[model samples]
Target: MRASVSTVQDLGMPAIYLHLLAELLNTIGVDERALLLRVGLDPARLKSTDLRVSQAQASEFVTRAIIESGEPGLGIMLARELKLPLHGALGTAVMSSRSLDEALELMTRYLTLRAPHLEVSRREEGDNVLFNVSCSMDLGPLQGFIMDAMLFGCVSMGTQLTGSPVPGAAILRRGPEPGYFHRFRQHIQVPVRYESREDALLIPRANLKLPVRFSDAQLSASSRAKCEEALKQLTEDAGFACRVRRVIETSHPFPPKLARVAATLFVSERTLKRRLQEENASFQNLVDHVRLERAGELLKNTGMNLSQIADVLGYADAANFTRAFKRWTGTSPSHYRSQALQPIKPQASSMRATA
Candidate 1:
C-alpha cells in the first residue's frame, strides 16, 4: 500500500518493539544498559510499553548493537523471539483473522502502530502474491536489519497462526546475503534470495486462502475495531510532527518555506505553527534537522565538496553551510568529514610504546 505522506514523519517505534530488542540483547549477553545509554534512551522509560522512542534513537541503538554484538543477523534473531502479545490490538486482530490473507491485510493496515516508517502492500504477479515492503524515510545502515526483522516476523507470525510453515514461501532481499546466511536456513525455513531488486515475501496465492487455526469472527471484528481506534489516536497524536518533517525532508531545492509546508498540509500557517508547537517542534527546527541529516549523509558518503553540499542544501554559499554544520554538530563540515574518514589508531601504550 502507498502510505500517505502524513505517515512519513519520524514519529518512532513503539517501546514494546524496543523491549523485544533489549530482551534479545540481554539474552545474548550484551550490555543492555550500556546499549540503551549509547542511544540516549532511558532504561526505566522502556519499562512501559506505551512509550515511544524517536526513530533516530532506535536506529542508533540498533547500529550500536550490531557493531558491538557482531551479529549481522540481529534483526532476524530478534524476530525469532517476538510474540503476538507484544503488538497489542493489532496482534489480536491478526490472530483472529479468518485466513492468512486477512491477517496480511490487517498487518499492512496497522503496521504504523509498530513500524511507522514502513509501508506494506500486496500485489499479484502470476501465481504468486508479493507482500512488498517499502520505507518512508531513509533508514541508512538500519535498512537491512529492519527489513529482515519485518519479513521474518511476518513469516514467523504466519507460522504460529497456521500451525505450519507458510507453503511456497520465499524471501527477496535487496542487499547482499549477510555473513550469517546460514541462520536464514535455520530460522526462516523458506528459500531466501538476496541481492534482489526489492524486499518482499513471495507466497503462492493458494496459501493466502488458507484458514488461520485461531480464527474467530466476533473477536476479529472487535479487535479490528479497536485497532482502527488506536490507529486513529496514534495518527492524531504523533503524525503532524512526522508530516512536517517528511515535507521538509522530501521537498525539492531543500527546505521549503513554512507557508508552503502549511499549504501542503492543508492547514493555515498559523494553525500549522500552533500544531507544531503543541508537538514541541517548529518549522525551522524541522528544516534544520533535515538539512543536517542530509548534510551529514552527503559529507560521509558522497565526494561532494562543501560548496556543492551547500548548494544541495539550498544554502547560498559554502560559508553558510559550514556555519550551519558547526552549529548542528559542534564541528565544521570539513572537520567532521575528516574525522569520519580517519582510520582508528591504537594508543601508544597498547602498541608497546616502542621506538
Candidate 2:
C-alpha cells in the first residue's frame, strides 16, 4: 500500500514523546525534571498534549538522557511504555479503527504529527507485508534509538490493537544486533532479524484483516477528521524556512557557515538563499533566531561566564556578544539574566493580607 505523506522534515516532535521519556527515566532513578531543565526545556511545557518541542532541543535532550542514564536501549524500553492513549489523536483513531490494516493506514498518513523525522511505506513480499520505516533527515547517533522506538513501537501497537501479537509478525533491522538487545530479547514477543537492508515490520498478509478489539465507527471517523486537519496545518506551516531553522538548530560549532548549512541540506548557496527568500526569510535571520534561542537557554540554564557564552555562540568575544544580545532584546545580557532568573512573587493584595 502506497500512501502520500504530507509533512515537513524535522519541523517538530510531539512533546508527549519526550514527556514519556522523562517518566521512563524517573522509573530508573534519573531526575527527569532536572534533566529537562538542564536541556533548556521548561518542565511545565511538556504537560500540554498538543505542545511540540523543537527538533534540536528534542535531539539534545534524548542524547543527554541516553548518556546520563547509560541506557543505549532506552528506545525499546520506551516503546514498551507506549500505550495507545498516549499517542493523542492518532492513538484514538487507531483504537477505533476497523482492523489492523485500517489502523496502519491512519499511521502511514498521520505519522508526522508524532515524529516528523520518519516516513512509512508498505510493500508486499510473498505472504508478508513489510512496513518500511525510513528517516527523512540525518539523525546522527540518535538514528538507532529512533529506529528502535519506531519499529518496536509498531510491534507494541499491534499487540495492543489486536489484543495479541499479529500472527507470524517479525521485525527487520539494517545493522548487526547490539549486545544490549540480548537483555531485552526474552521479553519481546515477536521475532527480530538483524543485518537487513532496512528497518521494517514484517507481518503475515492474513494478519492485516485481524479486527481491532475496541473498534468504534463514529469515534474513528471523528479522530481521522482531526488527524486530517493537523496534517494540513503542519504541511502548510513547514516551509523552506522551517527546514533551514532545523538545520541551524542542530549544527555544531555553535553557528554554522552558510556554505556548510547549504551543503548539509544538499543545496547550493544560491538555491538555499532563493528558497528562503521565497518564504520571506534569510539565512542570517534563521541563524540569529537559533543563536538567540540558545543564548537565552545558556543564560537561564547554565552559569557560563560572558566570555564562555560568547565563544559557544560563535562570537569573537564577550563585547560582541553583549552588543548582539542587547540588540536582540533591547536589554543588556546581565539585566536580562537577572530578570529571567528572578523568582515569581505573589500578588500585592495577597502579600498585604499575609503581612
Task: State which candidate has the highest lDDT.
Answer: 2
> How accurate locally is residue 41 in candidate 1, as Cα lDDT from 0 to 100?
58
Using all chains and alpha carbons, the TM-scores for the candidates as numbered come to 0.66, 0.68
Candidate lDDT values, in order? 0.78, 0.82
lDDT of 1 by residue, 1-355 (tens): 5334333565667766776788788888999887776555556556555666656556667889888888888889888877886788989899999999999999999999889888998899999999999988766678888998998888889888899889899989887787787856766778889989899999999989999999999999999999999889777766577767654554433567787667656679999888888877777777776677778778888999999989988999999988877765666788878889443222223212111
* Model 1 residue pairs with clashes: 1-121, 9-242
Predicted structure with the largest TM-score when compared to the true one: 2
Pairing residues by index, what is the TM-score of model 2? 0.68
Q: What's the lDDT for residue 186 in model 1?
A: 66
Candidate 1: what lDDT? Answer: 0.78
Error at 257, model 2, angstroms = 22
lDDT of 2: 0.82
